[model samples]
Target: MAADVKTHLYEWSTTEGSNLPVGSTVVSTNLDDNLRMIQAVVRYLASSGTVASDTTTDIGAVDATFLAVSGTTTITGLGTVSAGVYKFLIFDSALTLTYNATSLRLPGNANITTATGDVALFLSLGSGNWNCLHYLRKSGSPVTAGSFSGLTAAIATNTIANGDYNQNWTWTKTTATKPALFIGETTASSATDAVILELTTAAASTASAAASQSAHFAGICNRRIRRRQGVFGRRLLVVRYAD
Candidate 1:
């Protein structure tokens, strides 16, 4: 059988039997070639020169385990997808890595717009399929969710300010007016006060959370405050955040 070009692994024919005679030069050659292939694999890292990748990457022609890839074309497949085959890719430029359920799987089941210095490791599952094992970005962040840090106290559209739990925001509303809830998502690595607030409506009122830098508000909260009437009495209503 023909040897695999990528790993130089020789496959014996079905009819071929082991414990054959030593007079066969083909058997000796195969043994030597297999030894060399083992040595190459033991070396761990074989780097291919920077090359542009395409829809169907042809790393099979390159005798390397690590590839530095260029170009912006989306890559859908790698090599021929032999089971147990592994490839480490280092992107030299921005490109899109297409995600497929079977053919070319990715970390988040979403296409990745790779940046330079991004590295990804993939393993083949045979039947023309590849699965991404790990993906690392030079920016120290994944491509799954959008996040921001060092949020200031400035209240603008779609931006949150750093504050504490006791801080209160008030909104004036008529009997026909309704209030919308705002949600904030924070990462564990982020500071306690770091938050990304999302407003449900444009007319939704904003509030600060706290005074200290480490203060933060989490989960749903409800507050009751009185709104001044024309001159004499006041009306009280509940300001609550929806789940």
Candidate 2:
């Protein structure tokens, strides 16, 4: 008996440097469709979008790279989205993002931008709702100046923004019996990043809660704060831990 190995294959094959002009025949099959699906994905990521102005270009349903013309941009949305479907968004500069669609959520449940040399991937959760999978760093300088603020009772980590940043601070947290560090992930997208309390030391801050209340970090990247046990009142004085 022979084993059946199913592989995604396309109906047509192309050689290197062979250009398939637009409006070419597209004969597809089940297997070929799968391959074309992948091909479409590759095409999306490979294609770049026009320099987008504020709320000018509408986000397409493919991998379209949007080069920031100015500082930030707000693109139109795909009013109707399917669950598990996503788009690959690439940026050339540090630009903010916003959507003119209803219930479309990005990282932090808000309009976030891509850092230089970074790519932001957004996934649709059906019903016109979308969320950012995360921004991948393609090239360029890493993100910096990560500082988290205090939320109602939880630590407001998203305020620090997203990027590959280095920490150079003496960590501090609220007065809790079991205090821990967590890198709150992109809201409802990626998993919550956890920071091990490896070397918690005593703090001498005027707002410090207890002797062992500081969550000092060495040098960490992708610095996004997630408030968990940092009581709103008690404060954590920090400098940068490490890069």
Candidate 3:
């Protein structure tokens, strides 16, 4: 009789006596195959270093677990779905990893633009599903610059819109006027202590404020406000940051 094999790992299962007396060749062959499979899984081999990425990336047929993929194609999935499988992927160049709710789930529910040397760890959840456990960038810093708003004249009260609250902000007073007092929403308090600056002179002064603190901004935009009165024309530059 032929030896039974496990489904997931493809390991062999046979009675001890099945190989006794006239040892069955089937059992021995199946045992060797299982060993090979186990070895490949444990080997953690790397690819030839030029694997082009596609929608579904193949780390390797067997042994390869660490893959360096390069291509313009956006990867949406990894190798065939099998539960309890892990893959470490390194981006050889800039590429996008699409976020999918079912097939592929990313950290922020947003597509990631990978930089060279960026690495991501993924785990298969069976049923053609993969979840990114971790993503590390080579630069070690993730910064997003938001749009800059320009003001023509000085105003009595400056309000930060709710939408602009969640970004790293750099406000510059190119015009010569600066707001005297900074007041956010009466109910809104700062999420954390962030860097606030006061530029006395118009030296193209640049100041940054934390974006998206805890909740709403209390209806105030990030502006460089000083206690002393000055001109009010300003440009609001918003930058989104991730730590």
Candidate 4:
């Protein structure tokens, strides 16, 4: 004799703040129903960063270099960057520095061997808070190099060190206004190193918002688990959603 098989159905309303009683049912499951709900939600948030006319309202080509850091260097050649939050990509290569008893500073002792390959990005928190993100892929080196956002605050002060390539930077600016790209390099003779820089722009506000929402939803989804068991034994399903 074979064991009897039991089938069950579950139903939940999509209404806000509603909880229904849980019970088994004999009706056929509607697999497509849940997928439709998810699709709808994703579509709603998908257009946050899309712009209609990027050319008319985007940052164009810009090039900037920082040989000596006396004050904050503002990238030039870029027209007024839009008022909204913006992210920047930057690349730096060829750094030479001299160290004294207390500080490190860039010296005219070294020069970047290759001035066209380093890269970095930054998110400008309006009013002088530029967060730097960087990336460097050395010539003939197998390692792919990059730095995450929030690495360091904008270089406000310059320090000098003896026999060290202490402070050298090359960067570009881009945003919703001038979306062009550019590169630059800095080097010191005493130091045998070179740096390259490249830049691009990203949407600071939209990206951050999406990341936060994803983290919140992930936390909720991780706590729930679904299991099914039958003649084929037991199986567990874990579901996670992100945008």
Candidate 5:
């Protein structure tokens, strides 16, 4: 008697202008299927990297890169940066910083200074790759001298008039530990408000909670269904095969 061998071929399709939501099971098939799924994820991330519109209220979403500030106020939030380089995008009218620790000062040659409504960028150094260890910010008022132990350097300040706006802060993190990314919003009459801090890095020392396996193939089938649709629309497929 001869041994029997079986092979399976799968085909799926979707119409245009449809949003495909992906789940896990469909992602664990063969190397080819996995690679196609990963490519879709990368495309989604790349598309989200651009900045979005602003809002009147402080509440907003942080895409790959989008920040919006409204009114005159001050707010504080925590930033737990991973051990890698990062860019901090500030989308506000005016801002100021108050370092929480002396060691958190920006590099001397970073060229970060305080000015009313001036767009600026700062680079952090020393730790992993010049990332900030810790820091703070204040709005509605210029950062006063002696706000922190390391008062030798001038704080970066920007001023914005009524109905005017300023945005874009590109900073790099060079440390493994997380730090605070603060913001201060200066309103028209010297008053200020604060915006929330949006985190960009993945959680430290945490594992994904997804299950290892499942019996139902509907979840998996739906994933393949979505991928087939995405590939047809995007016209480009990036596949990574690993056994």
Candidate 6:
């Protein structure tokens, strides 16, 4: 049997001891869902360093990374251990997978190899033990990044590991401002605060929605309800958040 969701109507009222002079039409949903995921979801991140060119080091955690290596044909070693679930992919060519498991372990107790643009998911049970959950790669086929058009903002088609990613980040649309959730620059996960983007822009404030428009989205976007005494009123706004 599946779990049932309970819904309720939300109303804006006085927060803490302060009361707003005006009323608000805002609603919030309390989620009580269950996820059967063995490994916790983590933020996307870049590798600490090139695999083949230099010995790699992956900290244990639930995170993501792209394998980028140039100037070297063979891999040295993935030193240290960052134990956790990881989504490791290949963005460079000729990079082999090497890790020092003195403090960790891999399934089959062996090192893995991947070509350029190959993506693999793994879970580390701490102490250097890791298991490959899923992987995507083809023989002699290096999957390089290219133009993709699924999002409103087109992250221009470009290859990774050429050290030219700063130039390839071209947004297609200018009107829409999407919040950056995570930016995988250096080899740091969100937990380490190595690649987390900052929210510099102030969030826009807007009025709440009425009961009639409450259930419908695009009604009152992430409008913060504040009790202000003035002639000016707030309006509904559409909010967009990216991660």
Highest lDDT against the true fold, candidate: 1
RMSD of candidates 1 onward, in order: 13.1, 18.1, 13.3, 33.5, 34.2, 30.7
Ranking, lDDT, top scorer first? 1, 3, 2, 6, 5, 4
- What is the number of backbone collisions in each predicted candidate, taken in the order shown? 3, 18, 10, 50, 27, 10
Candidate 2 weakest ten by summed lDDT: 2-11
RMSD to the native, candidate 3?
13.3
Q: What's the true lDDT of residue 46 in model 6? A: 41
Regions more than 4 Å wrong, model 3 = 1-41, 45-50, 60-62, 143-197, 200-243
Minimal lDDT window, size 10, model 1: 3-12
**Between prediction 1 and prediction 5, which has the larger lDDT?**
1
Best candidate (score: TM-score):
1
Query: Regarding TM-score, does 3 or 5 come out ahead?
Result: 3
Candidate 5 yields a Cα-based lDDT of 0.32
TM-score of 6: 0.27
> Residue 142 of model 4: what lDDT?
24
TM-score, predicted candidate 2 vs. hidden true structure: 0.34
**Which residue pairs in candidate 1 have backbone atoms (N, alpha carbon, C) closer than 3 angstroms, thus clashing?**
163-210, 164-209, 164-210
Model 4 agreement with the true structure over 1-243: per-residue lDDT tens digits: 211121111112344333222235222354344445445434432222221112121221122221111212223212233223333322233321121211111122222222234332333333333333332334433223334444674568775434534443435744544524333324433643222321222445332211122333433543654454553233333332343
lDDT of every model, 2 decimals: 0.63, 0.47, 0.61, 0.30, 0.32, 0.40
True-structure lDDT of candidate 2? 0.47
lDDT of prediction 3 = 0.61
For candidate 5, report its TM-score.
0.26
List TM-scores for all candidates, in order.
0.51, 0.34, 0.50, 0.18, 0.26, 0.27
What lDDT tens digits, residue by residue, belong to model 2 across residues 1-243? 111111212212344333232234443334455455666645655465544434533343324534333345554453344466555655656666664344555544455556655676766666666666675666544333334564455565554454556544565746664435554434444435333332233466343233434265533444554434444233333322433
Clashing pairs in 6: 25-209, 59-82, 60-82, 60-83, 61-83, 90-117, 104-128, 105-128, 105-129, 181-243
